[model samples]
Target: MWGGCWPAGPLRRSAFTRRLSVPISAPEALLTVRGLEAGYGKIGVLHGVDLHIAAGEVVTLLGPNGAGKTSLLRALSGLLPWSGGSARFGGLELRGVGPREAAQAGLVHVIEGHRVFTQISVTDNLLLAGYDLPRAERMARVEEALSFFPEIAAKRHEKGGALSGGQQQMLAVAQGLVRRPRLLMLDEPSAGLSPVLVDRVLNVVRELQARGTAVLLVEQLIEKALGAADRVYALAQGRIVLEAATSEADLPRRLERAYFGDDAVSPLEA
Candidate 1:
């Protein structure tokens, strides 16, 4: 049977910090998914997804709009119904779990679009994310999240709606960290932000990885995603058409292949 909640213990720590003792050895896989399928109603979006991420790896999922990237993430986070497949994190089955249970399972999905409570104070919004956690631990995690985004920290007393778009986006991410999840899944984090704010958000993601949190990021900025991720998966029409590594030097060609297949001809050719 699957575990009842997302994390089995208190404020689940990032697995990245645990392997520092054996620096020479490779980190173990923290999450794995196979043959995953899900959708809204009868229209299937994800058609047998397969993926895995090591304890400290930054794996980005790239795709055009409506290619099922968000659907796949929702399935992983238990926000959507799964038709079939296995999702395992740290050896636990996540087939029928709910989103809250997934969060406790150390797999936190920071949804796209700022979903902060409009009427609530910034601190209060964060408090809601960790209401299940003990007070002291919750406080600690909130502080840690605030440290990553000084803009949010300064506006902790302000209502969520009062913050700028960039600041609200920062809060959305901060709210996800109170549980101290091992795998942080982000969707279109750079959407609607200025280039400078986008860099700030990406920097936070890098810091999270540095602190040993595995990241499954869905970003549109090809260069930024490639720069931050060790491996990249590009989904086209509900399928992963290509995957490549940053060290491969032929990354441009790889991306081209993923975006437009080799057989695709230029307009002039037609």
Candidate 2:
């Protein structure tokens, strides 16, 4: 689906590159993470995760429940603090960063579950996303974001509660687009929706890519996720177990092995 092509730039050495011990220059990646670790209060969830996302590229993170997919996104977006390791976004370090700072720095996270303020107007919901901006700029950004979802844009004046579940999800994504983030991280965007609605939502990823906005997608629909991303990373037991281009042969089989620890030999090992 990725057409076996990478974005035009000097590619950086990623977790997969390190696995092969390939020599490369320092990373110029839009987002880079090395040996990242995080957890809730006393329960650790992530361990030494390494990843990188290039500008204008779509990367999907796939894993089963409890594989730390959500936790990893939270850590990168500053919703959860990292206990160890390092991350940099657009040349800014992520240590001690909060959610607001992350968004301001163009690293926006659209959390799962289609969370929204049901009592407010759809425009108000988007306005709140850009509240920190000047009034005119904020309004203009809201209009720009709404353009991505005409379904909700038509209901701009209606209360958020009036929208269906799928529309709410679209609004949630529009909220992230308000910031015009350099990198947008989505967590399980297709959790609950009809097949058509699911396709509608995933189609937005292609639109974003066309606009040169990078995306980190965490999805349950394996086929859809792979279809939208240029690269895939499989996380199992809080660590990245597989990283490969979507165009590679036998990827589904390799992913299966990575997830279940099957004893079959992998191309990565061949």
TM-score of each: 0.86, 0.88
What is the C-alpha lDDT profile of model 2 across 1-270, one tens digit per residue? 222211122212232223322212234689988999999988889989989998999999986677789999999988898899999998789977999999999999999897999999999999999999999999999999999899999999999999999999999999999999999999988877788988998899999999999999998777788889998887766778778888887786766455433453332333
lDDT of 2 at 80: 90
Instruction: Give candidate 2 misplaced runs (Cα > 4 Å).
Output: 1-27, 262-270
The lDDT values for all models are 0.79, 0.83
Error of 1 at 18 (Å): 38
As a whole number from 0 to 100, the lDDT of residue 113 in candidate 2 is: 93
The residue-level lDDT of candidate 1 at 84 comes to: 87
At residue 260, what lDDT does model 1 achieve?
Answer: 50
RMSD, one per candidate, in order: 11.3, 7.2
> Which ranges in model 1 have alpha carbons more than 4 Å from their true place?
1-27, 263-270
Q: lDDT winner among the candidates?
A: 2
**Alpha-carbon deviation at 88 in model 2, angstroms:** 0.5
